[model samples]
Target chain A: MKLTKEDIQFIDTYLENSDVVFADIRMEIVDHVASDIEDRMSASNTTDFYNVFKDYMVQNKAQLLKDNRQFLKSADMKIWKAFLKGLVSPLTPLIFLTSFFGFYFLYLNFNIETFRLIISYVPLIGLSGFLLTYVVYHKAKNLKRFSVVERLAMPFWVFYQIPNIIFNFSYQAKNLATVLWIVGIVSLVLTLMLVLVCVSIKLFKSYEKQYKTLA
Target chain B: MSNSKLYKGSLTTIILKLLNENDKMYGYEITQRVKELTKGELKITEGALYPALHKLEAEGLLDVEVAKVDNRLRKYYKLTETGTKETVNKLEELAEYIKTMQALVNPKLA
Candidate 1:
């Protein structure tokens, strides 16, 4: 007892009206409800989609919606935890060390003004480039509206302001020690930004692969 | 049947064990399989089942694949390599727990 396209659409519309709006989540729920309805219809040897759907909803809608909310929260938490874990991963020290030496070299070779300009603009440029690439990838893949992708992008957007924050504080350093401290801090920030970019790319690639294969 | 709480704690193990036996399963299929296996003794609600599935997924213990079935897309879940390994450990843990409970609840059976 396969449901008609109209039956499927009816369930989709019902869910959307109930605020289960994310396509990824809605898609799964729609299938679940449709499957449930089909099973009931077959078992009863009747094809009353509306009555079966209504009964299923009466019994299950609240719980389904609750599960959807719980999933969203847990998904957000998992993404943040993964991002934070990536920040302190084994590769992080290497990135930090390289960034430290790189910043130290720039500070030594360039005048303070030039160093400040380079430090400020380099991360900004890098972040901007990453943002652009992320946007273009989503646009090309047509995955812009996925709730999971939006959650994954949240940390990157939050960390995107790190460069400007560092830039603002870079001006306050007066002595060599203070400058050294700033350099170390900037290197740390760079490492964080780099890790954020890597994690985002890894997660996005995994999802892109999943979606592509599924498609 | 009256001891859903007893089963609540074991849902993850149940899901992993099912996926371990079967290659992959969708949400509705998993529910139906459980129902059939239990002979109507245990029923997993959508609220409990999906959150559990998503949690396992977030933990990287499950991987999802979507296929268009009939008129719509259906999401299927399967155990990952880590998940497959974890399934064995979880089953062992569950076995131990059940033994302890049996010994406590029915010494003659133990």
Candidate 2:
């Protein structure tokens, strides 16, 4: 009583289409559904994989996806809150405040054009770095080998791209005053991206260690 | 199957206790084990089981490992050190709750 590769692929496709794109969640659903189907097939007279799988999916898929989404939503909130807690703590907050005021005063008094430009583009740089890392390191290099949790967390990186989209469409920072205003917002976004990356990397490392023992 | 609502509250305790007894178990194996142990009186639905397992892992009460079995990757869950500690507490708490419920429901038995 086991599922074939084709059966697994078919389940994967179904899950992807049904908004179960996160690999971590997808893998669980796959295992649960596949196991149940195998048990059913073994007990029954029929050996048809498709029919058995379809029957189970028709009965249980919606409930399974609903339960998973509910869990992921809460889990995502907890992870975000933990990262936010770190960022808002005494030391980190003081450091960020000092950096912000330092940058603001430098731009305010000296009016350096290059510094202003770089400040204005901090959000764009952060977003680009995220995109580049994801495309090169994550998608290209190790997507095939990534554990389920890693794949699930990939979609959350889209949050970093939001600031990039805002900057692209509405940005008109030609002067230091405009640069100062936009830079603050951009720097905030950049900090958030950094926090997200740190949390993701930490999570990936733990997940990798957990899976490595099985390998 | 028993009432899902009643069983829901105790699901985590049940899972932890099972993992405490066994070395490791995959999703299907866990469900089957529950069924066999309960003699078909309890059924762990896929909807309930997977979400509960994921939540437990997120809470650091369980750890997961994946291996290639029968040409497909099978993810197995085992209790972590913290999870082992938690199981004892949960079981004792559950035992207390059950005793209270028994007293209320069946005074003679209590």
Candidate 3:
């Protein structure tokens, strides 16, 4: 079947309904996929616009969807968020490493017991929390469903955490390190879950906004 | 035959009606169907078709499924129950709009 302006309009309608990337992407053409289908239905084949769209969808929607996904995967939010998440936390590991060495030296040469107290907790729980958040960040990046990179990084990026977790691990404060570790891990997980929640909220709000506009 | 303003208004309704008739539809074939049906009266623009389809999907008036066709992944859209009802309402509104226009222009028909 030859494509008409009305048919294009029908496809446009279909895209608007299904694939977000396709809908939000460029639409310089005034004629839509649905209109193409309409034109065809009114033409010689006697095939209704409904049947034609059905056939076309069955034949072409998969490819269109894949293209649509790729278009969305390359979406600015995904890339920008990923990059920003990666960018903002560049110093997390470094800070952790620095504290790790600094504490070790202090333990070797210095008689100061306070540094010992701090280093104990820093590695035990605080470091664990930071690492776990790092893990969550990586997981979020690998999975493209929702946005959850920066919040996970907040604990990891926080300058005081490295020393805090290490210092908490001492004999005098083992329990403190444990508590901090638990909180860090739980917070990281919560941050990840909240990312999904936030995306859901955005999607719902967007839907409501669009539905209202159409209504 | 081409580039008329009157055609644009019914575009969504036409898509909904077509989807109501058939279970689902994709991109290229929908375009082909239009050419075959219109007998060259209307030509759809790709730039326009994609964005509209997405909006309808987002609105929940349509349901989409991704299936493989001809070694390519295709996204198919079918009208929801609400979509079917809306299609009828929209068509009726369009008809009423036309009638109103006729009353204004050709009062004898009114």
On TM-score, the stronger of 1 and 2 is 1
- Scoring only the second chain, what is candidate 1's TM-score? 0.96
What value does DockQ give for candidate 1?
0.58
Which 10 residues in a row give candidate 1 chain A its minimum summed lDDT?
A: A141-150
**Candidate whose lDDT is highest:** 1
Q: Could you give candidate 2's per-residue lDDT for residues A100-210 as a string of tens digits?
A: 676677666764565545555665554565455555545554543343334434534565565556465334656656766665665566666666655555655555564
Best by TM-score: 1
- Give me the runs in candidate 2 sitting further than 4 Å from their true place: A17-19, A74-78, A81-101, A104-122, A125-129, A144-192, A204-215
TM-score of 2: 0.74
Error of model 1, residue A125, in angstroms: 4.4
Real A-B contacts recovered, model 2? 0.43
Docking class of 3: incorrect
| Stretches of model 1 off by over 4 angstroms after superposition | A81-91, A109-130, A161-168, A213-215, B1-3
TM-score of 3: 0.41
Q: Using DockQ as the measure, what is the rank order of every candidate, best first?
A: 1, 2, 3
For model 3, residues A1-215, the per-residue Cα lDDT tens digits are 44545545555556667743233331312123343444566665665666877865686566555555544433434333533444346454454345445555554465536645544454345435544544453354232222122333343344345444434444342354554443344334334333333343344343334323221
Clashes of 1: 0
lDDT of 1 by residue, A1-48 (tens): 999889999998898899886777888789888988898999999988
Q: lDDT by residue for model 3 over B23-81, one digit each (tens)?
A: 89875556556666788687554434544565565566787665433222346778888
Evaluated against the true structure, the overall lDDT of model 2 is 0.70
